[model samples]
Target: MSNGVDRTILTKEHASGTVDRDTDLETVLRNAGRLSPRDALRYLTPLISVLEGLHTSGQSHGSLSLDLLRVTKGDDGAPRLRLLKGRPRKPTLQDASPKAALAGRMLLYSSPEQIQGAEACEFDDMYALGHMAYTLLVGEPYWIEEVDRLGFMALCNSIIGGAPEPPSVRAMRRKSIRLPHDFDAWFVLITTRKHPDHFRDITDAGIALTSVLSNPDIRELSRSVQFKFNPNILESPSSAVPAAPENLRFTAVFTIVASISLAIAIVMLLRWTNAQESPKRDPSLQSTDGAPATSNPSSR
Candidate 1:
């Protein structure tokens, strides 16, 4: 039985003796660089078949990854894939903690729910398979940038919360491959969180993807299924962090104070102007007596 660890294997031609020349899927991909859609599908079909068989047998490859798979040549010289038997124990919150000893590399191919500590299921395997397909077609892992720049926790958070750009979009960025727009919808359908939204089976997914790549006239996904970032994962723990509300409150107070001051200043200015403009009583015109000082006296 194959364990998670690497081991020598014998090909049909070398059945009499074990051959240590088996290269892992990762190595093969690295050597091959970006593969065409048809070539990528050729490699993925066998893996998808294996997962389908496992699911049919009431089992799941809880830890499917590139390194766990080995590619060897068959008697016909065609590439063959062999999956290792053991699956890693799922990581938990404790395992994902900063002080935990688990390596982030182990979680590179993990599904969103898997990163969130959900129990292993066929969906997780399918999700990992989708990522593998993307890597083969796009020539790089989806989260490679996050892994390099942000460390394990950020990678985990990204997996849980971040939505991956479509393979076609990433291919555009790479400038090496051109994929159909329909393939983008197919990727979303396969990797969507809602299990019921996925294809009927892994075989169906493979067939759909093959059709999508080979035929331009193929219809797009019947319904749009966009994977938005999980707010729960992306939300900051410090809910009390200052935001627009505080700034808005300060602005409102300042505006009210300014308006009042402006109003008061206007009132005072109007009163001062009225008093200055008012015609003062002339001393010459004022009579010494309280009685009226008549202009008639001047006339006499």
Candidate 2:
């Protein structure tokens, strides 16, 4: 923090992840197999959105090191990541490089341009973002054989001159955790092979390459088993409900039943009324043996 109001770049109240990096990354590394490309996109696209905004505005964050980015629980208890602007790194003399006194973020996340002391441009930030992204998804940075051994000049040379393995391959090489099926190939295809013809336009023209994952080729690889989200983790939508309250609905049913009962009762009442209103049966006119009422008159 600059301790001055004018220089504050980050929003307030975020927790650092240094202590929690291993623990937080543990889940991602272990569940890499079950992780879906969509979820990955969700977790990462926001950071890209921020970077895109900065790059579009002709600004660049020189230090996008893993150590500076923090992950904390948000208001809703969902994990949120925030990046703090870090100072540019300068190589220490160490009786070797041009400038060694100044220090910044870790070199693991630094771009070749940054390593060589080139102007801190937006692409350099992108390179760092990509490295961080690879680490987040696969649990490690891309492999460079002499990463630790080759100090300063040699390290910078290798980083610039040699290509690193695809993130999936490096993750697989670690063999510490189970990986998603076909994830290695799918990762390579999307990140490296996809939309080959137009890749340069986004980079060379200084256009903000918002998201590489938006490529259709990358989406195609998602249909493969490895990138699929587990069905078990998918929360079922709440069951559809009637617009009316249950009590009201039940009352409606009860009213209908009562109406039917009342109708039946009314029909019975009508029948009884008709019977009472009708003339009395001619009991005196007809005999039990079908004889005329002449015998009944004498009896009367």
Candidate 3:
């Protein structure tokens, strides 16, 4: 579908009905009833794993956007969702925001000696999770209304420089959406610490996260999913594949052309040789020319 198309974002027509800024959050919540809190957690858990994986690899979802998220109902009547944001060559909706731009400057220009391995990666995941939490609680995508690219970056740098805010804080500030009382605790539980509360270390963190998904409530809800494939994987089928030697395709074409030409030459040589061969004359038969004088009438 992306055949040379520079598609950065896409939206779907509302299946249930039209939604607007004035639409009551309650109505949206009612429609979203199909997905329960447990279901939402199911989706979020795997997503946490995905984010962790991205962080470990020294990558971030450069193009994180609402379209990258998906929601579906599970067999148990709980609604689950899938979040798939791949690192992209083009700026994602967030990258266009002022927050992303400022964050980039501070990351690139600031003194590097103070930063250590995994710090940037962790911070990147932290902010990304913040955005994710905001979307989850709001039951829709969240974006800053303005597009001051530099200002956004600055905002991100400010957040990263100071204590990270709970999802509740961001929600209240950005969209005036308040979250459950436990919201802060949950946010801290998921994003702040290197390990989730249950896990003592990375290995335990992984196991604990996996165990949470196994919870019946979470399992029922994390069904509907969406994501963009990483562009790096799209480049070629295999990583070990070396770039084709210079002009390899061209060389192949030339080889085929030469073979065809050689075949034509051989065919022409055979035709010419046949043309040069002469038919033998029959001596017993009388010739029409004057040189055949010994010709006699056949004995009757």
Candidate 4:
């Protein structure tokens, strides 16, 4: 080995011309914006399975990111994903060296424990997978804007202390994307600090995430519901789509009208029932104005 370093050459079968050998997942994501639920699951499922297998073997991918993944097109025109091998040894955060601290965007995918000098494990990989899924759904890392403004150290601080914006809220910036209600919960669960709170494994997380993304309610709500944009919160004011005020107003008006009508109907029914049930007064005893006969008139 050169310079007393042990090296090994790895090879695979030559890919056909139809396969896109040059593009990595990061590039594809940058070019394609956010992926649809179908596409995101398609890419993520296999990646999660890979991590699952590694964990099963008592190993872990300390560094996981879109950049580390290779995406190629199959002969059948479907995209295929492969995780590229990295160093055999996982870096420990205890080193606390500037190099480790300055790992750049990779920190975006790191878990809180990983940032705090803990050994990488299945939990860390699951946390990274949650970030990757969010990236694919939201078109960028949750903390990318902060990282761009403040630097990598800021990202580390945020990971250790700050909570990320819910995936559904971030996805709202893209009007076309309608993430399910439970998506945010799923994200939080996997990325939580308590290891026991996380999914049993990456495979389970993937399955649960898939179920959240595939929810029919998202599609139905997308058709009928509109989201109001708050410029103070979302990054892109221009991309913020306003809620349909007319539809909302119509709904409110209809509800009020229906309530009023029901109340009137109930009142009229009560009056009619009372009229029919009231004891009929004798004509001779009844007053001319239809008043009840007053037996005590003479006494008065």
Candidate 5:
């Protein structure tokens, strides 16, 4: 347990040991790596076992704090994480139960202090797993941090207690720091509550993320097009890439023909209007010397 003075809360009937309190953050990170996808899942295998035990016993580790945890090397030199102290209180809340609220915060915010109440609901666990997967892929926190600071705070408020914001699409851009394709599955999985039928489960989310990230055909096509066109410097991509059909050569040709046809049609219409408005000379109008006669036909 941490050498710190934090009080321990009872997770089991008789709590055997305290929270891990080793001060080596690198060792703690190493232990975390054991559970993550980027590293061997063995080091972190015990965490799953702990979570499982919590699930079976209908109890949860309240007020989990990663900072307080300590890491010690086993005889085999593999990292082992021990709990140091219980969290002071629950981290965040949702409209759901304390457990559900905690789970939502853990998934949305990655805060250990708030996970005390996270129960093992299907959606909650799935979201948390996705959150873990995203952190693994991007080597950072959740995608929500990609937004501006205020927007990020507002998003945190919405996810935990405040009004929800629209799903962010800006994270998908190429210049974005953490690539959207990295968290494709997590995005789909988390949004599944909002769109159930599309992403059925975690497996589907993983597959979709993989496909978007690894599509060779799409990559090849993008490369081919990038080399083919020197887009107009003044135009944005939305304007440079016209909404014509699939075959770019045919589409460009057809667009040119259509534009020329429209221009000719407009010119012809303008000419017709100008001709109709011109004042015509009246043949019957009487005049002095140069003008002919005017009203003799009716008299004859």
Candidate 6:
């Protein structure tokens, strides 16, 4: 574990597959391996499992892009989704290079909150997963068109403030790109009808996306999505990634402060009520003289 007190060596295996056999998910998407909805679900199910496993191990794969997905055959000679690149490195402040902040890859795939200097958490991963889902379903990188034409700040502004068009719409616009029959329902469920201005977290949009992707058919997917929105769900329970201790401590302190403030407010409120209900001395008689004294109502 990195103590962040000294230099720690880190390594990432640079997971572009060997030249002869395997190809990245992006290349496949561009070519014949492009996924239909059913296939996309099939592929994403494993990816979610792998992501959960990473988080459970107290690591988040901060970088998840289309290129990180590798298409290779499993031991049984079936196609498999092998995720690669960026083993769980603790996000160090030193790595926050302004030059690399909005690099081309990030512009298209990074989460909205992440671009704003928020540390990458499972929520950020899930948000990026949403775009990845879009790329797979729509058979094209999500923001390629906009990024190609715009400047860096323009791209940043758009990703941060702009509303997203559903992937189904984009797929429909391309005559060559054919989406699956149930793609619309799936996209709508995942998006959760985002407000005109706001970002989505796992508690809201991410859980629905996760639930739907983990299931097989649209009917089952719909049910799973519905389950996440149910009041009884309480909070998102399957967050495989644990928050860092510092973050947890911060949350605890904030909660304590909030509770104390609430207690103080309640106490003050009770005191105010008691004062209102209790007997009040006549204004003039409040003086040493118990006899009433005349004074203008407006006088303090």
> For model 5, how many clashes?
14
lDDT of 5 at 73: 55
Instruction: List per-prediction Cα lDDT, in the order shown.
Output: 0.66, 0.48, 0.41, 0.66, 0.40, 0.56
For candidate 4, the TM-score is 0.59
lDDT tens digits, residues 1-300, model 5? 121211222122222464343353234454454222323122223333454556456554443323334456555565565544333443443333434433343334333223334533434434544444444433443433422232333334444431121112222232133443334433444444544343554445444444433441233222222111112211234223334446977978889999999999999999998888654554345375656666668798
TM-score of each: 0.66, 0.47, 0.34, 0.59, 0.38, 0.52
Give residue 172's lDDT in candidate 5 (0 to 100).
29
lDDT (10s digit) by residue, model 3, range 1-300: 122111112222233433332233224344773233444444445555565666667665543433445444445554443444433233222453435543453332111111222323344444444445445556643333222333554434333343334445545755566565544443344344442241232333334333442342343211321211112111222222334556887898899999999999999999988777633345545367736556357843
lDDT of 3: 0.41
Pairs with steric clashes in candidate 1: none
Candidate 6 local lDDT, 257-283, one digit each (tens): 999999999999999998896656546
Model 4: residue 43 alpha-carbon error in angstroms: 0.2
lDDT of 6: 0.56
Off by over 4 Å in 1: 1-19, 75-78, 90-92, 97-102, 174-176, 216-219, 222-300
Clashing pairs in 2: 33-180, 91-99, 91-100, 92-100, 93-100
Better of 2 and 3 by lDDT: 2
Measured with C-alpha atoms, the lDDT of residue 215 in candidate 5 is: 45
How many clashing residue pairs appear in each of the predictions shown? 0, 5, 11, 0, 14, 0
lDDT score of residue 299 within candidate 4? 86
In candidate 6, residue 199 scores what lDDT?
A: 28
Candidate 1 vs 6: which has more lDDT = 1
In candidate 6, what residue range of length 10 has the lowest lDDT sum?
Answer: 227-236
Candidate 1 lDDT, 1-300, residue by residue in tens: 132112223221212334376777788889988777766766676676677788898888788777667777666675566777545575643475664334566666788788787888887787787778778877787666556556566767777765545566556764557766576677766777574567766777877776765664555663455544333322234222333467789999999999999999999999999888665455666678755556877668
After superposition, the stretches of candidate 6 with alpha carbons farther than 4 Å from their true spots are: 1-20, 87-102, 174-300
Candidate 5's TM-score: 0.38
Q: What C-alpha lDDT, on a 0 to 100 scale, does residue 166 get in candidate 4?
A: 57
lDDT at position 168, candidate 6: 49
Q: Pick the candidate with the highest TM-score.
A: 1
Q: Local error of candidate 3 at 164, Å?
A: 7.5
